[model samples]
Target: MLERIGITNFKAFACQDVDLAAFTLLTGLNSSGKSTVLQSLALLRQSHEAGLLDEADESGGFLLNGELVRLGTGQDVRHESYTEEDPDITLAVVKDEIRYAWRARYGREDDLLGLLEAPSGPTSWATRDLPSLFGHGFQYLKADRIVPDVSYPRSHDAAVRRSFLGARGEHTVNFLRAHQDDTITAKSLQLPEMPSTSLREATDYWMQRLCPGVNIETVGIHGTDTVRLSYGFGSGVSASNRYRPTNVGFGLTYALPIVVACVAAQPGSLILLENPEAHLHPQGQTWLAYLAVAAVSAGAQIVLETHSDHVLNGLRLAVKDGRIPASATAVHFFRRNGQTAEVISPSMGPDGMLSDWPKGFFDEWENSLEQLLD
Candidate 1:
């Protein structure tokens, strides 16, 4: 897991360090710099993968517009912040026993090419032994944009496993179908003398957990290339359901990819989500929170950016109910000044109580209520 992220001059953050927990919730008002944090990580990963930057490589620092990293005069770049002095960008992470720091300078080529530096550390700022953590280690999901649609192609490949559902969850059905047979067969084999009905029954049980009273089954049509998914609501009440991934309510499709991604993600993976509660009813938002907690317990670390009080309350409830360890999560709120943003982190206790409540935090609702009563 990433223990800390230090950013400077790379957006709304002039210079800041954020401590990360196993599950970190970033909540803030609009333009508070929540998305900028996620984007910086993404860009760093992209630069590393493309060889434009490296933890050890020097001379070639982050290049902008085909030149070395340069300072911008305005907020032309999303979440970007401009400053009078030369800008600097640094990201730090702790994995296993090693802590690594990647730093670069930002300015025009005509000004001066900045150096890329990595200092080693137990206490050192950079460690060369740190492995490049990439691949599905990070999964980003933006709300309302990740739902499925008709353009999605269904797949039944037996060789493929642990794939990300595209931005739009178009691949949801195909992914489920592909995993269905193996999952059922594996569970059945685990139980000695398990009846054939066991797999069928278990499948139904899991489906109902997501949508109560809903029945999900697969049917093969002789002439069709892909298997079809059908849904019903219990016995004696059956109807062929037609859902265009795009046409259905946004909540279902938006939430589906998250579920699939969590279950399919590997250990040591980082899942970055922006507003997982978007378009979800309050009840569904609570359910989403539960799913997120479960994912963390399963060994995936999540950094969530959200504005929903319901989502925060739900996670607190999960802690109180003992569904998740209170120490396993951290909540951070971003507040903006004229041009800079500061992060405030509050730890949650086992009883769903906060150790310290920062002023102005979660007070928007209270302020609105007061205004109404006044």
Candidate 2:
């Protein structure tokens, strides 16, 4: 698991180190550098996947624009306050207690920033022992996910060969179509009320948390290169006719990728979620958090970026109920301090209470209540 991440001279940070846990929550104000942390990891993964981080490849560098992220040139990613003395960008990760660091030189118009030095490790970062970020079980779901559509792309390479759901979850429908019948081995991820552990059934069970009795269906159009997703209400003789994705509640289709990602996650899977609470109601957001917690209990690592107080409270409830241990979770509140961003981590106790609740750290409800009472 990735225990920590260190960023230097990167976007929104002159230098920052954020500790990670089995389930890490990144929350803060808009543009406060929450996404930057996720982008950094994606950038590294993109570079490594493109063969730019090969062990003996001297020309290896950071791939800025790729399937996972589209960060612009070096000037766009380099911190504005970087001093001339140390103008290079650096990213480091601590995985399994070993520190791996990389330094890249800045080029104003170059999207692929050149490497300035080899990684600070015994072997190159691209060896067979690469970080789990580059592993097959890694999934990065961006905030702007797929909307309700009649048909989604069908990519055999992406869905079957690579087991990828696409960075924006554009390939989720096809992935579901291909893997719907696959068994979910992790008991924690299995819905207790549902008898079958198949991915499709579990997805339906979880989606019911958002909209009760709603189920999903995915199939390939006979002559098309895309897959279609439809929703159905009820079951057996009382079942309603299947409805197209556009005909259902918008949140159902929008949250499908998240449900599939968590339900299908295996041991050692790494899921980086951006605003999993988007398009979800308060109750749904809390349930989504519970799903993520269950994924963690099944041995998957999740780094979630969210702006939902309900999601936060749901995680606390998970800890209190013994669904997951407090030590397995970490919450970081991020905010801008002048030109740079800062992070304040609050620890969780066994009873689901936080060690600290900094100003602007999901306390708006109380702040507003006090004003109203006055």
Best by lDDT: 2
The local lDDT score (0 to 100) that residue 319 gets in candidate 2 is 98
Collision pairs in model 1: 70-107, 119-126, 120-126, 121-124, 147-169, 148-169
Off by over 4 Å in 1: 55-86, 105-115, 118-137, 153-162, 167-174, 182-211, 214-239, 372-374
Candidate 1 per-residue lDDT, tens place, 253-360, comes to 566666655555456777878788777777777767876776676677888888888889988998999877888888988988877898888889899998767767
Residues forming the 10-long window of minimal summed lDDT in candidate 1 = 65-74
Question: lDDT by residue for model 2 over 77-154, one digit each (tens)?
Answer: 999999999999988888878777778888999998887765544445444455468777889999999998889999
Find the candidate with the highest TM-score and give its number: 2
